[model samples]
Target: MSIDQHGDHVLQGMSIRKLPKVSLHDHLDGGVRPATIVELADQVGLEVPEDTADDLADWIAERSDSGSLVEYLKTFDLTVGVMQTREGLTRVAREFVEDLAADGVIYGEVRWAPEQHLSGGLSLEEVVEAVQDGIEEGEDAAEQAGHDIRVGQLITAMRHTDRSLEIARLAVEWRERGAVGFDIAGPEDGFLPSRHREAFDYLASEFFPVTVHAGEAAGLDSIRSALLDGRALRLGHGVRIAEDLDVVSRAGDEVLVQFGDLARWVRDREIPLELSPSSNLQTGAISAWGEELADHPFDLLYQLGFSVTVNVDNRTMSRTSLTRELALLAETFEYDLDDLEVFQLNAAAGAFLPVEEREELIELIGEGFER
Candidate 1:
């Protein structure tokens, strides 16, 4: 049951890394390899805080562990700095998929803000194409290595920015090519999904899928806006939805609770909550409850019949993987293999893929767990 340096472990005599998993909340800019950053930065003549890859990893880890969203976001400046050009974007996207495959992720949605990558004179279309090219190359490489993996782009728009409508159009334009869904990331406190009403309306008209970043830095109001305005099929780190629950009584193995209308509807509808244990702790998303992983309302949400899916919101910054997130949860909550498998199934069901494809992913997970 001991985890290795790579955040992999054996559970019940099975390698956790070998289990089939789905990644729905992974971010492209957040998962850049430190070595790739160094090389790309050198090519672009961009200065980096750390020269060597190992030191650079340590540097990112320290900066992200600051427990402030603003401080954690600063680390992205370096990664985004190197990703402005087409080649840089392509290489990083390719490596992103490769890393996901190595971590045993069978399906992944790589979310990145296309507007951020267009700062180097590239058009939004060009940025999406570059990332698609990289993703295809990475898929080919994984197939050649005897591992099967597939990834899709979750075209994201910065919440504080005003280009969401443009980003939404870009996402729909590339829907047939590689873009699977749309998202609004960046700061969440002052910004609400309602700010992008036009974009969400456009997406809804086109029947495009969306997942909003809400209930993380914000609260129930944000989640409400995401579902009502953004038409979000899933919630990004919707951990704060726990605030709507009132623990009336607690017994040894049973607890009585009352849920607000929003919480009840979300749970009844089974809107998936992309919960990242480590990132929530680091970003203080779950601070209202406590400062520890066990204090996270993940177990409560799961027990309360919510569609709770575990994720690595940012692998590089958080220094985690899907396997590691699952392992950590298992240790904290004394979860077994069945619990891990249920999380994977939830993610698969909530993926932006077609229903048939999602069913296939579920079958894969079932087989993997059975093995």
Candidate 2:
């Protein structure tokens, strides 16, 4: 069951990468190809730590595995440095879709803070348009290559910044174009979703979908704020919500547990948790549980009936893909093909697309798995 260097494995006489999957928590800046970064940086006069793509990949992996969120975030500085221009943004966005399509992703949402990319004299609208252009090109390229993939933008705002309301407006502006939803992506500990109540309120008024990065760097209170203030349709790495559950006892396969009010609400409401296994381990998001992949409460949440969907929070940083994340969870929890299919279905259901498109995605997943 050893996964290859490409983050793929053979399971049940099928290749994991060939299975239809939905990506709901991927970050546009976090999943750039190191080689593309190097080339783009050279053209843009940006300095990179490593000259070669392989070395740059190793460099990102090292920095991300440093067990410090700040250190991990520093890698983004280099990636984003090369992505300030319209050409850079479009190229990255296009490559992101191609990568997902190659990984057998049928539907994906690429989230990034537009405010972060405006440093190079590009307007908010311009940045979104560039990314949208890239996404469409990527889709056309994938179709030509005999791989069908559809990706949308999840225009995100920095939680610690003051531009959330503005960013939310930008997302709404592009909803009919390529933007499918809105999100808040920076530090989540001190900057709870409540801080962006105005933006969330506006998004809710417009009937735009929202997802918040909660319960990852923070805890249950953050999750509460995401629901009450952010109106998050889904939780971004909401793994820490398990903290609210009290394990009373365990007898063989049955474990008795009591859920707090917040936990009960999240579970009963079936808010999808974007559980990223490798990223959670690298970022120490699951430190309270333990320090290994097996320590993640993903299986617990899944068993307890949380809408647990697997995701690759940052492919480059975590050195993972959807195939890799699913393989890690399957290996850690001894999950079979059915478990993997269930996770894909959960992601498809939680996607920001309309109900009809979601059902189409579900059908695609079912057919892919059946093959």
Candidate 3:
């Protein structure tokens, strides 16, 4: 099985890109097309590092591959800078959904922080509405193109900011208007989910779905805070939870392991880990394991009974898609079509959609894979 230039591989005589998939950890700003960024930046009179879209994409990718989350996050400045207006936000959101559909995503949840896009004088509600408009348009366009896709918004707040409570309110207010969930992204080391307990408490009171960025840049303590304080239904790149696992021994397809309480609870409860292979490597989230895709603890966590899901945390930064991430994992771990299907199933189950909707997505995935 050989992967093509687009990171597509044929397994069992089927192209990975044609398989139905679910995306739960995708970021809206992080997935913007470089061409769109260049065009939007020009309209807004913002200076970009590169003039052409291809060169700009290469610039962003090279800078983002710095292997440090802080430095990697700095790349967002350009994306967010261009997305401060209604038109910019809507266009980006629309293109994001369209890209997901083209990649064979049947269902996706797009996460982006509203606070970061308010610099253009748009209100919080306005930005959410803008993105919603784009999502609807993208969905319609994809349907016209014979690719049925649905995307929901995960209204996110920057972890280092004090707007969590406000953003929680914004997300809940727009719950019926395409907002599906809430999240806290940005730096994770210094800002624990506990810092936003008030916001989490409000969300819990309102019964809003929440996912926290934890166990990536930090370790078990961050994961604990996310579960205990943020009431996270899913963990964003919770790869570092592997730190709690003590690998006693290893053999071909069999390994002895000692699990700490945190690891045991997370595994036993089957908390979904949004593992982004290429993004995890670029951001140094899985540095403890190694510097390559093969070093990811994804196989270990999967074998240990953890609900592991594949994702493209940032498509532009990582230069990946769900198809590519799955293909890379299959190539690295020798996974078969069945394994790829399981990852999609995990994502469907962990999606911020209603149970019936999730079940429907699972059925769609099954049928697609069967075909």
Instruction: For each candidate, give its TM-score against the true structure.
Output: 0.98, 0.98, 0.98
RMSD of 1: 1.1
Poorly placed runs, candidate 1 (over 4 Å): 1-5
lDDT of 1: 0.94
Candidate 1, 128-227: lDDT as tens digits: 9999999999999999999999999999999999999999999999999999999999999989999999999999999999999999989999999999
Q: lDDT: which candidate is best?
A: 1
Per-residue CA lDDT of candidate 3, range 174-213, in tens? 9998999999999999899999999999999999999999
lDDT of 2 by residue, 170-196 (tens): 999998998999999887778899999
TM accuracy, model 3:
0.98
All candidates' lDDT scores? 0.94, 0.91, 0.93
Candidate 3 lDDT:
0.93
Q: Better model by lDDT, 2 or 3?
A: 3
Q: Which stretches of candidate 3 lie over 4 Å from their true place?
A: 1-7
**Separate clash counts for every candidate:** 0, 0, 0
